[model samples]
Target: MSFQGEQHPGVQAPTADSEGFRLNHTMLRIKDPEKALAFYTRVFGMRVLRRLDFEEMQFSLYFLARPEPGERIPEETGERTVWTFSQRGVLELTHNWGTEEQQDFAYHDGNAEPQGFGHICFSVPDLEAAQAWFDANNVTFVKRADQGKMKDVVFVKDADGYWIEVVQADRLGQMGD
Candidate 1:
């Protein structure tokens, strides 16, 4: 588990205290709520667990997750909202109310000159099938797994121009059951 003998002088292994935590979610801002929702749900098969609209702040939040096969989303608003926060790997898309009307509206994808955020990632069960699906559907490709030096990683752009890294679990040496 060590860094293969390239360790820095002051580096040390992580302590056990980090074991209690898990990543809950990552947030991204979108120009149009409907478009963004459709892209995530239809393309990735994620579902909207809950949506919270902040009228006073002129914005709305949509929480989505790839639901388990037999897991049902709750019927009540309160219960559903709570359930939304309980899952890991949640994607929160925020829509500023009026951006849809602005013809030139675009959120900083963080890949331009003063680059900040790069991309988010998703693991697919089959790399070749996933790549073919993206191609047949005309999804924008920043880099195809076979074209780049990385050889087994795919990068596509979301509706908002945000890069999304698509990796196949099998390609990572973890074949699906």
Candidate 2:
């Protein structure tokens, strides 16, 4: 199962021991946990699955995920932490203690001259509706769905200037030339 013209010259087949392996989460460093948390939870519709604080290190980790319908989240700290780690597609936000207090502190968004990391994506049920919701919530847009060569895809920026690609899963098939 490969794309029509894509090549993977040096790729090897998966080994048996790696069968159960899956991506758990992607971490992003944020300055203000409050604003980041609000943007993620209110705008993206994600819920905080678990939060771990390290007083000695003066930092905290917040794990968030969009809960499925009828899904139950564990209440106990130990159990919730374990559950959060086990789930796939989780977003982890790391907040350093004093960065929030600094007036001119900012993290590299990886989209400038020395670009490295790219963007994270979220698949929505309805692309148009999602766009409307984003507009109503005052979310910043990098590109609108109709702006680029690619149609039916939107890119928005989060509170920390992270690009989030939004698309409808069913429409992805029609995106190819």
Candidate 3:
């Protein structure tokens, strides 16, 4: 039997069903990428995997990741190092330069209420422990006394007034309960 760049019937190709879809990252507009990146690093322990600068457009791209301590990673040039790379879940930050008004920040009055986009959540292992960390850091929670439906999930506002939701990973399992 002769074959010419072909496979027999019922045979699957090497690339068939090889890889699955992975959530690369969630991109969000940030008034200040540096500030937001700092907050994420300080609060959530996320590290800056890489960053891109677009001088012509006056914008930047920052990719963050959560990696194990001293984790090694392959550089884009194929060089290996223990600096870690963006994997698992990533947070992409886009910073637009110049004097630009943030349409999202317009509707807010100190603790009056949470209007428009309420908050951005980050999953944590321990809810109480995470809440305590926020408290120790002097991060005020909006309507802390009255959490409403988000009682179990503690809310803390970053310097830019963006609410951060710290909820237990297991609690997320009870969502459909």
User: Could you say which candidate leads in TM-score?
Assistant: 2
Across residues 50-164, which tens digit of lDDT does each residue of candidate 1 receive? 8899999998899999988998888999998888887899999998888999999899998987999999999998888888988877789999988956888899988899999
Off by over 4 Å in 2: 1-7
lDDT of each: 0.87, 0.92, 0.67
Candidate 3: lDDT of 5?
57
Prediction 2 global C-alpha lDDT: 0.92
**What's each prediction's TM-score?**
0.86, 0.93, 0.65
TM-score of 3: 0.65
Judging by TM-score, tell me the better candidate of 1 and 2: 2
- Report the Cα lDDT for residue 99, model 2: 93
Candidate 2 C-alpha error for residue 48, in Å: 0.3
| Candidate 2 residue pairs in clash (backbone atoms < 3 Å) | none
Off by over 4 Å in 1: 1-20, 173-177
- Which candidate order results from sorting by TM-score in descending order? 2, 1, 3
Please count the clashing residue pairs in each candidate, in the order shown: 0, 0, 1
